[model samples]
Target: MSTPPESRQEAIARLSRSASDLEARTTRQLSHEAAGQKAAGQAWKIIADLFGGVFVGLALGFGIDYFAGTTPVGIIGGVLLGFAVSVWMAWRTAQRLMAEAKQHGEPQSVPFDDDEDQGA
Candidate 1:
């Protein structure tokens, strides 16, 4: 008897299924990464907002005094204090975040579950 003809259609279908599976897996992984990035972006925005508020307040105070032809004492003082407070808050937040992250840690699998169950 002659050998069977190579089933090109079957081969193509198998490859198509494998490619679809890979694409699905890759999509899931990318979605997970995107979520993490989104969270990080939110955190960054909060930090930026804090810094921006402090800087804006200081600049506004300075502009008011300068345009009004008033003394630089108050303006300079406000700017210096504003910068110092913002920097201190940022540093403290960073420290606390690191500490909490260390304490909460990452998830891990069960090391040694019993294997005598009915199901293999």
Candidate 2:
């Protein structure tokens, strides 16, 4: 029995489908990677903002204590101020991110659990 010739039309259609699938997969992967990178960058920025505030406060406090000879008072005050600043910075960052999310129509929301207290 003679084998039938391969159909050029079928071959083209198969190639087109394969190309489409590949393109879609590539697009999806790229989007996922981009989103991951963006998230990682944001996290790093948040950490930096918090720690930066604290470290700056610590440095200032140490300087003041060294110069004023007030010892722990300067350091303690500095640390408290630094913590407050850090909290404020974090809040602002969260607000900015939330606004951006809303602008993007994503409107991100995080769920909180208070059940632990009830269980206890």
Candidate 3:
């Protein structure tokens, strides 16, 4: 003679299955979120490396020149090179951002298309 599912043992077994299912689902979601975060971190790391290289180059050059007592030649040349590299990096970053925005089906980015007619 078996008791109905309303009995305590049957209800407990159902609850256990549900709990396990929920745990599996939660684990999958967390792993996906972690992967996304890691990818974003990698992207930021690339950009940071570019900027950090420029910063280090300028700082080291200026510091060396200051210690060496060579006024404008070393320091200014380092600064000019760093500035040029940074500007180029910024332009590339802007272009990438614009392309990403476009990929998302976003509105037209005006500055990216200078040939567009702006009747304002």
> What is each predicted model's overall lDDT from 0 to 1?
0.71, 0.83, 0.71
Best by lDDT: 2
Q: Estimate each model's TM-score.
A: 0.51, 0.77, 0.53
Where is the poorest 10-residue window by lDDT in model 2?
A: 107-116
For residue 106, give model 3's deviation from the true position in Å: 28
Model 2, range 68-98, lDDT digits (tens) per residue? 9999988888988998899899889989988
Candidate 2: clashing pairs of residues? none
Residues 96-116 of candidate 1: C-alpha lDDT, one tens digit per residue: 766877896873332232542
Residue-by-residue lDDT tens digits, candidate 3, 38-120: 65876785577567757766786788788998867776777677767766776787677668767868443223233423532
Which regions of candidate 2 fall more than 4 Å away from where they truly are?
1-3, 107-120
Model 3 CA deviation exceeding 4 Å by range: 1-5, 67-73, 76-120
Candidate 1's TM-score: 0.51
